[model samples]
Target chain A: MNQILVVDDDRELRTTLVEVLEQEGLQAVMARSADDALERLQQETFDLILLDLVMPGTDGMTAIPLIRRQAPRTRIIVMTAYASVQNAVQSLQQGADDYIVKPFKIDGLMLTVRLNLQKARFCEETEAADLDKIFNGLANGLRRQTLQLLSRQGQMRFMDLVRALEIEDHTKVNFHLKTLREAGFIDQTSDKFYQLTTNGQRAATCLSYICKSLEASAQARPPIVP
Target chain B: MNQILVVDDDRELRTTLVEVLEQEGLQAVMARSADDALERLQQETFDLILLDLVMPGTDGMTAIPLIRRQAPRTRIIVMTAYASVQNAVQSLQQGADDYIVKPFKIDGLMLTVRLNLQKARFCEETEAADLDKIFNGLANGLRRQTLQLLSRQGQMRFMDLVRALEIEDHTKVNFHLKTLREAGFIDQTSDKFYQLTTNGQRAATCLSYICKSLEASAQARPPIVP
Candidate 1:
């Protein structure tokens, strides 16, 4: 069963969401605060998180990063009563997969939850096959151009990247390498040589890739100052 | 005739480009320096520019901003004999619509020139309709998230954006806004409302907006203590 984590300070709502998720044919765990959520996330693997944005002591917005760090691959959805567009857009930027307005209907909420989870699964499979380029889409468009360079060249050398892509000193490239390696999306055979971690080179769905390209580019950073 | 300006220190290639454009039944003007190009740009309107990247002064990389400042609508393409992928990418980041390696086949070069000019036309038209959103797309994903809040709400109103987007304070928003405005992609109204300028919103074709957005976020200074 796909594992779901429900994080809310509301005891009653947490219980209700858990019961509902269990009936939906998945394993669900509840955390009462962001700290608790982090604790649970460290020990458990979750496919999705149903988070409350306004929770007391480590709210969804603040805790989402913790959740992300703990389970870097998990999908998170923020559920909150204060449903401004800013909240919706910001939470998504903060790594929440989707947001639900408070006082939502069970049918719509369930549908949203199910669809998000399904998308997450599809994305995971897609990422493993494509090397997380798809996940980069959900996160925001980053690394696609570098991937484009790698795809075209078969591989990128250290000096070429430093000279061509960024004006920063080479020290910055080292930082980017560490980040890419830590993320587990890229593999470095040695210093100064890098490729698309296998999955990045695969040619796949054009539309999804294009859409994700927009997002990935949007989310990308220059690996490191180098 | 579609008028073009050629800016290069190489006397022979500059003359050849002008000859080719004229033979193609388009008007092309030649300049041996970036200063000459800037002066011509200020005095006369041109449809496009053929810029060299490695002249003694005001190279294509440095000249791009000056050209744009002088004639915001003029399309430009950077030319270089030496192909440095990093230089090409940096030129794109700096706002040249397209580039050509030295010893370009006139046919291929003309095709790209045509395509970029057409694209520029289409972009100009699009920007007239919605620049704020378009410019936001040019920024890195994190900054874009904050910019989206500013764009969607029409007025940032400070508190809502901070809480809704989960940002800490007023300074961060302004910092991103300053970059947006400085790039000439955005403008703040008399009442201090930030909006995207026409070119700022629609000028991005090579996905530089993602980098712009990320840079601001990564460079975001911490909130000041009162």
Candidate 2:
């Protein structure tokens, strides 16, 4: 489970935030002060830290560098009741991933938290050149359709896949299948049944999820009847 | 609610499919044959249709064109037990969005359904040049971060956003903000506070969701220990 550290001086707010984070299926730990947060950070790594800008001692600004030094990969989201241009600028420069004004809606806060964690993970995963291979495999519509077909069927033979894909060019289908196999997204059995590898399954799932979200977003917008 | 019509001669499979679709938060209606499916199309408009290929009467292949003529917008997925290269090609030529081999995993089926719906909706929403505008607005990391910030905070003042963004160059901040506003992603109040427009919020949400899904995919893969 992804762990988050929530640091705030107000006991009530801290408790509420922790509860909400836990409800969202993340492990939440609380710290009453920046000093406490820093101490906790030294003990274990956290995926993210929700830090309050104006704590009692060692304000969020002061603790930013300390937390970065302790867990460089941990993303920080700074919250401030007295939100200002200067503070926002300072926080971002201080290595904070984002800043939220106090009195934020819970839904908005959750979105921020989720997005930051994703951004951090994306950076980590793409730190190498493997992303290039993944992109190459997904570059063509035919290959993507192939992934979609395999994702549904679990495993299939080459001829059936070509038929299901409805594309008549046999050589094109062969080329795309070879590319996917070389990218480590698929494996062909001795009997000639092709199935997605673990990486392929994850990639296909992500692609489907993204497409769904984009559609939902578009639907949520009011239709512009021209 | 998105409504789907499932047509299959196999009563048990149709029931299982309806149950699964309902479980996934969609309204599913069933039909016994291609004739029955066409009747349902005339009675009610559906977002999607799942057609079985090789049914007893008015088989799937014969019904594809009739169904498309009746409801051109409704995306169709053709399912077949004897999936072949010819069947796949014929299905696409007949206007099917995708096809799945019979005996598919329920999870894979759901993914296909979700992706096709998304693809259909995306095409509808992007029928004009609006998509290019949205992409242009999202082209810059700084602009995307700006959207992320606004999405979380609801609104912010000019200088505060600059501070939060941690960029020292005023001209750059001004440029990105102008780009967003012109692209219809944001609005500026008379008081100089900036907030995302409805479209902006939807786009931002979609971006966050996609990023999160991609990260999840990356995490699911075996770690490449460097």
**Candidate number achieving the greatest TM-score relative to the actual structure:** 2
Docking class of 2: incorrect
Provide TM-scores for the models. 0.35, 0.40
Q: Judged by DockQ cut-offs, is candidate 1 incorrect, acceptable, medium or high? A: incorrect
Top candidate when judged by DockQ against the true structure: 2
List, residue by residue over A1-226, the lDDT tens digit for candidate 2: 7789999999999999999988888899999999999878666779899999998889999888567645555788889898754466456545465788889999999987887777676755553344345545655667777886787566899899989989798788999998899889999988999999977875565444334434544434543221
Q: Write the per-residue lDDT of candidate 1 for residues B1-226, one digit (tens) a residue.
A: 5778898898988898899878877788899999888877656878788999888977778888667544545677888887554465456545455667788899988876776555445444443343334433443544545444443343554455557667677788667666766666667678765554543332321122222222212223332111
Q: Give the least accurate 10-residue stretch of model 2 chain B, judged by summed lDDT.
A: B217-226
Model 2, B1-226: lDDT tens per residue? 7789999999999999999999888889999999998887766888889999998989899898677655655788899888754466557545566778888999889987887676666755553345345545655668877887786566899988999999999789999999899889999889989999977865675454344434534434543221
Error of 2 at B222 (Å): 6.2
RMSD of each: 20.1, 16.1
**C-alpha DockQ of every model:** 0.02, 0.08
Count of backbone clashes for each model? 24, 9
Model 1 chain B poorest ten-residue lDDT run: B210-219
